[model samples]
Target: MIKAQGLRKTFTTRSRKGTQTVEAVRGVDLQVGKGEIFGVLGPNGAGKTTTIRMLATLIAPDAGQAVIADHDLLKEPAAVRRKLGYVSQAGGVEDIMSARAQIMMAARIHGVADPKRAADDVLKRFDLTEMADRPGRTLSGGQKRRVSIALGLVHDPPLLFLDEPTTGLDPQNRANLWDRIKQLRESGTSVLLSTHYLDEADVLCDRLVIVDHGQIVAEGTPAELKRGVSGDVITLRVDGLETAAETLKPFAREIRVDEDVLRVYVDDGEHTLPALLRTLEERGIRLSSIALDRCTLDDVFLAHTGRSLRDTGADA
Candidate 1:
């Protein structure tokens, strides 16, 4: 439903030093298929929002070509807007307006044939019928979020843009929202999502692109990206970390040292553990803790960007 190439955006900020250009998004390319949830995963400052804004017609890219929902993004923005729904990062609903009223107004603005009925159906779909009459300010964060999504979906546009959909919700609410997003895909609404959460990208996205420093570093399905990082992850909490990592390099496919632990990637953790421990013992390394698990998105991010998403994103 969306295809973009060579998308770039820059901002000029005035400071004491003088005007400086900040390349917020540089050369981002994207392809989102119909009836699928495609994710743009990255850290806070990795241009995820900037890229989404460019595609949503809220901001024009400095240099790029994009077509969304079969309409040229730059040339046919109004037609593109008519076919898509955008829920910004800070989802908005008037504090004094009830959820039902807000959604109905949105539907009317979008020129839905039956605004009231459309709003009601969307409220029911998002399980917000019970509190539909409550003011936005009175609702919980999760409830407000649901209401915002319902408002965006009331017109039933073919495509949806969600920026950081579940950033602050609790686990239960997050899962609830996940089900709703899945239902949208099942019912054939193409979705474009942006998130920094590793697990969200892994569980929700059919395919994703990992962005860093204003550029896409890797792109693939979650499993494909994880599989690209060879071997299992063996994390060790040990003293004398630097020496131990260097000594175990021969047995490890890759090694990354965090603040309090060393994450070692090895072909076979079961067989490698004994030999690794012996080497540490012989080298007088003091072991505090150890864990072995399959490689995850963090490992993938590390492989591609030389940094862990766990350190940068708001992890669960």
Candidate 2:
């Protein structure tokens, strides 16, 4: 229920030398189908949060156009705001208010006639009912995060923008929140979430767009993206890059050697392993460990962006 075309945002700041402009988002094109859970994956400072802010009507784009829930973001931002529920990267709820109070207050501000019922419904569905009376300031980080989620969802808007929805929670709490997000989508809420966790995006998103340097580097289902990498990955713990590189040259489709390991990409690791072992044995290259597995999102990212998400230095 969301579409953005040629979206761009730039920020200007004064430096000691002169003013410099930073392009946070550049010509980004995004589409989220109705009732679909779409994910934006990137490392910190990749403009994921900036894109979300622009979509949520919290920030205006420097260029391009967007239609959120059939309302133009630039032309009819008020309507867009009415249709979207935003959970920002920074916390949104009050510290001292209880979860129930926070949600109820949000509903009232959003013009919901029955704030109590709205608050109760969200609390029950999000599994915050037992903790409704607990003060947000006194709650655990996960609980406070849940309260923020509840506040966003209290109005039951058709479109939701969640930035790092499960960033700081424990595994169990993260799983619990995932179930609730799934339920929201099943009930026909369109969600667009931005996250750094590849495993979370793999499990929770129907499709994803990978962003880097404020631009989309790749977009696909997790499986499709993984399969785009052309071979199996073999991790070999062999000392001496020069020796391993020489020994592995004939058997590997591509060879990348670090200080004490050689990563080989090949069409057939199972068959290639024997040849690789024979070459290593013939050359007397000592091997400590060998592992073969299919490529992952990290590999796909490296292929596209020449950098891992973990290495991207994104602060957000």
Candidate 3:
């Protein structure tokens, strides 16, 4: 339902020194299949939101081209907007408006055939029926978020752009939203989601691209991406982490040290553990604890970016 090629955007900011150019997005290419939930997975400042903005027609790209629902993104932006719904990072709802009022207003703006009926249906779909009369300011963060998404669905667009949809929701609310997103896909609504949460991408996305520093480093299903990292992860708690890192470097496909712990990624953790232990004993290093687990999306991020996803900054 969406295709983008070499989409690029740059922003110039004024500072005390002078104006500085920031490449918020660089040659970002994406494709979201009809009825698929595609994800743009990245840490903050990785251009996920910027890419979404360009696709949603909220911002124009400095270069490249895109098509949304068969409409030209540059030449037919209004048509593209008519075919898609956008729920931004903040969920942008009026705090003083009641949930019913907010959704009905959006319905009217979208020219829904029956604005009141559309608003009522959306409220019930999002399980906000009981809170329909409550003002946005009176709702909890999760309830307000639901209302925001309800507003987006008032138009019944074929595609939805959800940028950090679960950013500030509690675990329960996040999970609930996941269910709602899944239902959307089942009902044939193409969803393009941008999120930094590894678990969210793992569980929610049918396919995803891992973006970093304004570029795509990897793209695939969560399992396919994790498989790129090679084998199990063995975390060892030991003294002299630096020395242990170097000592086990040859046996490990990859090694990272955090304080007194060493995380070793290798092809065969069970076979390598005995050899590692023997080597440590020979070097007179004390081992405190050791554990093995399957590779995770974070490991995939580390392998591709050379840094943990959680370490990225908040701005792109």
Candidate 4:
């Protein structure tokens, strides 16, 4: 149970001997229902982390009203901290300490009555029992990430904040972490996760808010966001894309030509692809590749932001 209204945070920095203020998070309104996994999706420098820091009570917001599990964040920060757990991008682990020892120290700091028992339990749950005695620095990247998660959950807080939980992990490790996050939600832990991984949000989030330039641009379930596009997407890569594009103009609801790839938006991709292929063949265009699929969150983003997620540019 977390809620925020008109949440904003700003910071001042010196650049080239000149001072400038950056509005990291501006008027962010977020609500996380009990036991729900709410996701914050944004690219780098999009204020997702800034909003999370404010919600965790680690940083004060410039203007906002926030409540965490019945405690006002601005008025009762200590009470809010007792009810929430935070796992940062840096993985929050001491390199020299063993997993069990590290978690035990965290439990003790949180004033858990049975710190030893709690540490043992979390180590086992996160599959770190075998390496519980090993120093954190000796653990593999995946292992260290899991240990960080275990530390965050050691206190058994009802609400959890995970900022880029699987940032640099391999695919296998990423999936493993996703499973653990899902299990937490199933066990009634309200999770607020910020991730740039589109597929991760598509698979794990129940509801998501897309943030850009320190503001929420869109909010919906994955299906709702995809459906916002209102059609199938047919992608064709052919030599002489400009000529093929001119020929396919009559059939296209919306056409975008990027390099040699021609992206056509239509009501039915199955029907559109055949006609598109026929037109290309008639025009003697050399087809390189063709891919047809339903719309995705990336498409939704491209539609709203006028740029692909993977576009290479200084702004992206």
Q: Order the candidates by TM-score, highest first.
A: 1, 3, 4, 2
Name the Cα RMSD for model 1: 1.6
The digit string of per-residue lDDT tens for model 4 on 77-134 reads 9999999889999998888989899999999999999999999999988888999999
| Superposition error at 203 for model 2 (Å) | 1.4
lDDT of 3 by residue, 127-170 (tens): 99998998789999888788888888899999999999998888
Q: How far does residue 60 in candidate 2 sit from its true spot (Å)?
A: 0.9
Estimate TM-scores for all models: 0.95, 0.92, 0.93, 0.92
Clashing pairs in 3: 45-316
The local distance difference test score of each candidate is 0.90, 0.85, 0.90, 0.88
In candidate 4, which residue ranges exceed 4 Å CA deviation? 238-253, 283-286, 312-316
In candidate 1, stretches whose alpha carbon ends up further than 4 angstroms from where it belongs are none
Give candidate 4's error at residue 256 in angstroms: 3.0
What's the C-alpha lDDT at position 294 in model 2?
84
| Model 1 lDDT-worst window of ten | 307-316
Poorest lDDT segment (10 consecutive residues) of candidate 2: 307-316
